[model samples]
Target: MGIFEYAPAPESRAVVDIKPSYDLFIGGEFVPATGGVFKSVNPATEEVLAEIGLASDADVDRAVAAARTAYERVWSRMPGAERGKYLFRIARIIQERARELAVLESIDNGKPIRETRDVDVPLVAAHFFHYAGWADKLEYAGYGPNPRPLGVAAQVIPWNFPLLMLAWKIAPALACGNTVVLKPAETTPLTALLFAEICRQAELPAGVVNIVTGAGETGARLVAHPGVDKVAFTGSTAVGRSIARAVAGTDKKLTLELGGKAANIVFDDAPIDQAVEGIVDSIFFNQGQVCCAGSRLLVQESIQDELLDALRRRMGTLRLGDPLDKNTDVGAINSAEQLARITELTAAGEAEGAERWSPACELPAQGFWFAPTIFTNVSATHRIAREEIFGPVLSVLTFRTPDEAIAKANNTPYGLSAGVWTEKGSRILSMAKRLRAGVVWANTFNKFDPASPFGGYKESGYGREGGLQGLEAYLDV
Candidate 1:
């Protein structure tokens, strides 16, 4: 659909009262951090949205101390059912203020309002709700007769899906009876700070969930804090390695959900139009900031020309503009730095002999933006095929057989997720089993659920996030 097909209906920013400055949420209160202050920018307009407090080493100490005290005296000591009630309250509050939160997320994180409202916010609530039911039923969760909370959990989340990633970390940790000290990415901290208010509204006790906001330094201190018993991080692989080294000899139980260069394999018998839509949704959703985005397209040689033609036509219809607009399909890049990385990699793809192609789309000149792009004639050795672009850029390579597709898909060191598009049930099963990925989608991509486990293998990091299995990440048997 073109922009003219649907009249422009932008969601109201008036719903969100963006404060001039925000403080660290620690001990169930908004406290000042000693780590100085920084501005959080709206990537869509390059506007200064809010002044965010940076968390210093001492701030990390204070936050971890608060979490430890809470885990020691209050949260972990509370009955599981009571903890569950608190979780349920937070979930309801999220739904109640969904519009406000979605608006804030769009401006701060640069994802479209349609996505923030429909996917991110809803899934965040679902995560909290899913974990709440498990609060009183940990015993039956197959962990043990009595799985214990892992004390204070230090969680660090990335910028791509800020609020949703917070839900993935905090909900289960709290539901499992652990107190948390969370550090949201510096670039997108508004929704997380708003979530702190939701905790207060839910009457969650002081020191149970603390948020310390800053850049990489803040996250580093949080993960390395001595009082923390468990560490869960979601970001880049290089950062994941540093965390692994930091917590290597310590007793801290750690789970890392890092990067991916996933493959979306399309077969000759697959539904062409349907696969094209899935492919677009896979890479272009959230401006392709997803960790498990289908950046690599492995199509059967017989259907290559047919699929590419349809895919190009579909890409042309993708509307790129204001994030708050309901009609927009692609939004701004998260930051200038991230846009630079995408630009450098896409340029590399072309330099390495890949044919670069993008629909005729004009980007707003004010803020960070990269047009939705794809590279054809890409080889296995091309940098674009091997590395995670983490943007709306797809690399297309052809395969003649299922085995070739499998080999091409698993060629990368990062095996977080993959998609198989085929009509044959037997082919789906066979390909899914053979693909070296943590999550395999038979006929779809980018589908997530609170009940299903999501994580990756290889350098994509260790451990699962959303499911009964995720409980173990925060509990001690």
Candidate 2:
């Protein structure tokens, strides 16, 4: 399908109706939890899509126990090539149901359908296909000979890219022969529940992959559960640290892909229009909910004014409303809580004396929304410049030279990704080498491929996903 075909619609009362009372997937079957049930809301309209069973501490234990049993009896002992076939089957199924997943994802997560269809669904499939090939070729991976599977993996993903993040977590774990008990973010559990159906369609072994839906407390239960052999998390830095501390005394391996305040540096020698487009995609795509968003723009002093003008023009042209529309560029903020957080952080930026500018745009009533905001004259120490606002907010800071740009870019605790906009190949290589991030895009931003290893340095969290290195996270070296 074409990219433009997935544009989002404006706000309307129309809602995606999800089945009520989704059960936890345990032992390859949909089963009710012993705990209470909770409803997941569509952030765009505040409509409940599904009532999901909230897994209690005991439920998490049961899920982990089931995973451990599956790991020992079936999944771990399965032939590697057979496991690859199962993954391939699941990928194909995902592609078949791509549109449904896209619509459901947009309804549940409040991201534009274009992103859900073009980016999230496709990448989810590609991730599965990519890792499926690795299942039968473990010896070729950089990990040492006779790599063994980690037992039961407890994975918790964020709300931003629910199903895609679930794919990233489960594909590699299954490929490495580890059974998974995944917990999707409470605000967006529909897609993950739908994914459990896909697993069933693939006839995956019972207990091979379980989906537990709940809030932070349930996630803590799953992660801190004694039966979990490893924990893979993608969320905020604070929660990542907590999970790190939770697993400190245990032998459980941990892989965290946390928050980022990436720098998108535009050099004087860069292609201005292209760099502007890259900057827009970096910060504005996914309504700036992306963890590795290029929230900080460090432009060369020579081209700061021109780049800022172009960026503003681009931001002004963005259509904001209706995640399901076929024309929307920006969608609603995920939830009111997140919008409040963005507002608070932006207020801090203004209070800290950074110049804030947002295009004069009308936001729909009755839905959580934030205009695309840009802060100029932002210093390294500015609260907005230093902290991760995590909405469609960008902080523009200037640097006079290459060294200064690199220094300013790496000043933050985040090192997830960086964007260097330059025409000169030598400059791109040099600046990329100096940037302390995992993924560096020379002329682009937020480009993801299943074959590329992706993660971060410093507080952005550890462990790579999507490449051969991703397999290492699930395998015992």
lDDT score for residue 358 of model 1: 98
TM-score of each candidate? Answer: 0.99, 0.96
Please give, for residues 207-326, the per-residue lDDT of candidate 1 as tens digits.
999999999988888888889999999999999999999999999999999999999999999999999999999999999999999999999999999999999999999999999999
Off by over 4 Å in 1: 1-4
- How does candidate 1 fare on TM-score? 0.99
Candidate 1 residue pairs that clash = none
Model 1 poorest 10 in a row by lDDT: 1-10
Q: Identify the candidate with maximal TM-score.
A: 1
Cα lDDT tens digits, model 2, 1-477, are: 422333334433244447877999888888888788988877778877778898888888888989999999999999899999999999999999888888889998889888887999999999999989999999889788789998999999999999989989999999999999999998888889999999999999899998887899999999989899999999999999999999998999999999999999998989999999999999999999999999999999988889888988878788888888868888888888999999999999999899989997888886899999999988899889888889999999999999999899999999999999887999999999999998999899999999998999999999999889899999989
